[model samples]
Target: MKEQNNTTLMTTTENYEDYKDTTFDYEHYEELCVKHDIRRFAEVFLPVFYSVAFILGVAGNSLVVAIYAYYKKMRTKTDVYLLNLAVADLLLLFTLPFWAVDASIGWKLGNAMCKITAALYTINFSSGMQFLACISLDRFFAVTKASSQQNFKKRCWAICIFVWTTSLMLSITDLYFSEVKEHNGKHACLPIYPKDSVKEVTALIQILEIVFCFVIPFLIMLFCYTAMAKVLLKTPNIKRSRSLKVLLTVVGVFLITQFPYNVTKLWRALDIIYGLITRCETSRTIDLMMQVTGSMALFHCCLNPLLYAYMGTTFKTYITKTVKRFSSWRKQRTESVEEYTMYSESHVEETSSFSI
Candidate 1:
């Protein structure tokens, strides 16, 4: 009787799989479930979101680069770290158009583009997070060693180079895991592992992402920021200015933006293990949730520039002065030109009167 029941269950499962494949019944429902609601509400909304992210991210990051490049006064030891961060953010934001197009047109861009988009996005995400961790480490060392602190300024450039090079090197994993495939008449970026190694590969990658990208980074950031805060608070009779407040605000932003994502990521990693054991379909929902959270996570690229504006005292002061001086200089130049023209006209009139 038990054997007969097991056979009946196997037959039912096979029939369900056949139904899912041949009948278009549940395909549309699954597609709808996976499609981002913001993308579905208006065809143009995804494009608009991507455009705004690109504009703000590029402009903000470019401003960071320019401030460090053109404004000699803004070039500090810390600016070196920020310069690298801006570069990463800019690259990450640039990839948004690819994602936007995929979401907007429902992945009509084909396989090559899908791979390229995934590669760029993963590279930037990993690299940017790593760089942020580097920044926290820099701060920790700078603060802890205070008087005996080695001059990090001279070494910062080398550190920046290493950060970017390592990022590019590690980001190739995306190509291995992602593939563009036709699903429900739309191309989708699916995580396709080696058939035999799928379970192990998914588990390994998810664990690595959580550990390297989130858990370690968050702990480092928390430690450095906490230590920094304690030190600042202990400095006797030191009145905190608006600038100091801005600096603290920058720390707050990092914690708030990254903490939730990290928590969710860790939970998802554990869920993958559970799925591996139970053979459940939970990975699908996790992937969808990750997409939405990941989109929100991308906002960090935009927010970092704002943090730079508020926290980088040299950048803030120099940029404002430069703008004001340029405005004044332009006004003075216009007045001088007008005066010269008027004088020239008067001289010509006087010469005509004398001739007459």
Candidate 2:
């Protein structure tokens, strides 16, 4: 009986040791699975990228807005669309600095800021893409169906309103779900859906974003530009080649900048729905792809002003006139200052001679 009791105690001790080992192993596995690489890479890459993007995007988009506002250059439906596009780009660019700081030092901003920033990012991004489509459609109408220009012009405001409403509606998910949540020992501003429906919600949102922000706009631009190209080919205008080149550049740049990003987003959506990636390494690779492609996508805002506004003949003329006027005004001010100084000196000298 004594030996049997001793054996039972030994058995219990072994069982406890086994359980502890198992728990430790499980926890160590989870720790290994944590994506330290992603955090390190983002901490290094995102801040610099976001800063550069913010500077260039703000400068370019602001110039577009300033030029349009100062010159009152909303002469055409295209102009109206481009102005709205500039505004959207500016709004989108404004969020970059926040993200830059967040990437550098986690999301120190509270949940409210997280929601606002995320919602603004989504809203302005979708609106900007839609505006690009609107610009393409307007240009197509201008070139192909010149008779419909008046009707399109009348509907421009309505179209702009629709785009804004649609973007806002799409961003409702971000506004609702975005939170400052702790992740891997740091807080991040991201959408955190209900645990019960997290996968469904994330997949749905990503797919919708891809569809509205990229697919629809890309299709519109493609169709309109292709049709325009056909028309240009048949026409005998001297600017046909230049127009074709511009169209190609626009389409090419859009594809190069946006396609890979959307592809990564689509992959992420699929992974959420289907668990396509199982390995930690593979998941980390996807995250890195997302980071790089997203940065590339954000570069489009910097190019929008140059491609859509500054490249236009009328806009170039406005820029030239504005620069010349500024130069002339500066020269006149300098001459006035010189003349005033000389007059003051001459008057002082004359007074001194009279006194003598």
Candidate 3:
């Protein structure tokens, strides 16, 4: 039930798409009729999809980083998690152009690049989801536990360190296992997992991925937001409507886009562990569904800054101020350059007249 190594985050940018790059050898994979259609679709659709994602993801995530770095004097506890989330999004998009090229063409890049790109893709994907958990937990404490501002500030860095360390260790598993293998004269970047190994390491890793990426974060968000909504309703000064809106939107988008991909992965993992794959059509359907859902997950990253960060009035103000300041600076620089050119021309004329 393993897919092509690098076609997607869940599938690791996997198999069907690679079939497109290998012309004469397509029949071998064509035996899996559903997969054959998936491969064809991947060739046409994934390249375009990944390209759009790369552009929007980089632009939106970069703006998030900019607002935090240049616009804000000091970041709050929530801001710390949000900033790391942006970094993870940036990292995820960095590997996308490479995958886009692979989907459009093939893994023309060699094994080293295969390892690098796959590892980066896996790392960021895993870490970004983990940060969502951190965000939820931080909010939960802010609402329920009622820590002092100083205590919360101190906890932010410590919690950040712990979560990032754990996620990096989780990510490094891909770095160790990811490899480039030749398939029908084409190269692919994917994890090296044996289906029937005695150790069952591949299945174990897959389960871990579901747990770390989808399960824990989802539970944390659900519980925290539920409690947060309750607390906000009780508070007299704070407007509950806006906070509730943002909370619901954040949770809704993630679950809708993320559930399918992770659930598909979970299904595949079980199929591999128990040998339950009875029909190629069913498997192929899962493949198509996974590809589409995974793209939605990527889209979620693009929306992170908007859904979580920009939903705040304070954050919107900072973004506005930064844009205005940048525009003014650019205008001033243009005027200064024009003035210098005018002065140089007049000085040249005066000097020429004196010489004559």
Choose the strongest candidate by lDDT.
2
Worst 10 residues of 3 by lDDT: 12-21
lDDT of each: 0.59, 0.76, 0.72
RMSD of 1: 10.6
In order of appearance, the predictions have TM-scores of: 0.72, 0.84, 0.84
**Candidates in order: C-alpha RMSD to true structure:** 10.6, 12.7, 6.5
- Write candidate 2's Cα lDDT for 264-317 as tens digits: 778877865665655657666766777778888888999998898888888888
Candidate 3 off by > 4 Å: 1-34, 151-154, 194-199, 236-238, 333-356
Cα lDDT of model 1 by residue, 1-356, tens digit: 10011111111111112224332344443443443432243236546766787888898788778777777443445567777788888887887776666554556666676566667776677677777787777766676665342565667777877767766665566666666755434555655566565545655766676666667777777788678667666666445455347547766776666666655566655543442312223434444344445545677788887875545566788678778887999888777666665678576664454311
Q: List the residue pairs that clash in candidate 3.
A: 4-14, 4-15, 5-12, 5-190, 6-12, 6-13, 7-12, 7-13, 7-14, 8-13
- Candidates sorted on lDDT, descending: 2, 3, 1
Clashing pairs in 1: none
Q: Could you arrange the candidates by TM-score from highest to lowest?
A: 2, 3, 1
Winner on lDDT between 2 and 3 is 2
**Poorest 10 consecutive residues by lDDT, candidate 1:** 1-10
